[model samples]
Target: MQDCRILITRPEPENTLSRERLHALGLASVPLPMLNIAPIKGPQEQAAIRAQIFDIDQFDYVIFVSKNAARLACDWLDACWPMLPVGVHWIGIGQGTTQTLLEEGVPALSNPGHTTEALLAWLKPAKMTNQKILIVRGAGGRPELGDKLAERGAKVSYLSLYERQKPIYTAQTFFMLPDVHLIWVTSGESLTNLTDYAEQHKPEWKCLPILTPSERVTLQAKEMGWVNARCAQGADDNSLIKATELHIGKQND
Candidate 1:
């Protein structure tokens, strides 16, 4: 456990939890949040979003892409509809998103792989012709889900609740990170931003072990010159921490 400091690139309160879990396992952690999440700005956009939320029951299905989307959707839906509509099918892309909905008193279904490809596979057999589907997520993300649903003849609508942006960094503070044996990142956007940072400021990180939540992100990291990138099962803290243990320990051995 000694000298096994992991640079956690997850955002906000989540990073705090990640650090706590790493410490519990006798591993050290350094928080370096790459994504800054904020509600979608502009009054017209807010009004339009509110109108959409008020009519949530009109959609045949609602798919949450991340925990942030789930939490925000729950809050909005709870305010308008005390009892969730029964006809709508709720889908979560990953276990974490599904768990968020469940904890919010709204049950959602998701496959084990926790990737968009996995969700699309499970959704392939469903009836989508002329159906209305709402995809809840941050401002900018992969259009694959919506595009696939459209290809199936489903009318898909995106309800973006927030925006994910890279944090403003004025300094090239590579030394601020601890002796990072492994880097834990959850999303492709975060991975891309962090990879850019490494290329510009911390070139050495390219050779160190890194864990990504999905194979797509792992591939992205590798393409960006991170030679030692590995994919974890899921983005949740426990899965990341467990994978971190193996990678960091294997390196030490």
Candidate 2:
């Protein structure tokens, strides 16, 4: 929206592109990252991750649930495989993750929709009766996909590569956000963190409009006392921009 300052609550590196896109469209934004995507770095964890990478071929389908997962998986897989093992299907949850894998030399199938339920539907659980699926993701990622697959008699496993940690911010940072007209929250954890902080420090900010990635999350926002919560079409920048346009147009009406 023109001149409307939106708070981008994505982690660094990723938020950089979001801010750039918003600015290019004559929108103002403030970077207030809610979470940090940090790789799992302990010695035991590293070995476990390495072992998963080396044994990647055994999984009939390997799913990269996010761009973070794709990036780390490609890096680790590159170290282990001069060429990706044949007959192992690569899957990504969205365009961003699929594109990341493509750029990293892993041809992958992206889910037709942005949500786990959509991906599960696309995979056709009936046919997955005996498939081996590996979801490569950050720690504490959603287990819905794996659980559904397992319920269909498929063997499901995970290779957790990173953890989402809440970022530390001073009181001044929270105080500086009064002019932010909208907030874009990408994940459940981010929404919870933002809601918790707002409830404690800026209860009035609950009235500010906010954008989430899906209808489910938008409902979550409303339940958390957000007066004008909205959901973007998807988790991509294009979808977010379209949603913002629709919102501002409504105000102009």
Candidate with best lDDT: 2
lDDT of each: 0.86, 0.87
**Candidates in order: C-alpha RMSD to true structure:** 1.6, 1.3
Candidate 2 lDDT by residue in tens digits, 132-151: 99999889888888899999
Model 2 local distance difference test score = 0.87
lDDT of 1 by residue, 52-154 (tens): 9888889999999998899888888888787988898898888878889999988788876788888887776458889999999998879999999899999
Worst 10 residues of 1 by lDDT: 170-179
lDDT of 2 at 60: 94
Model 2 spans with C-alpha error above 4 angstroms: none
Residue 246 CA displacement from its true place in model 2, Å: 1.3
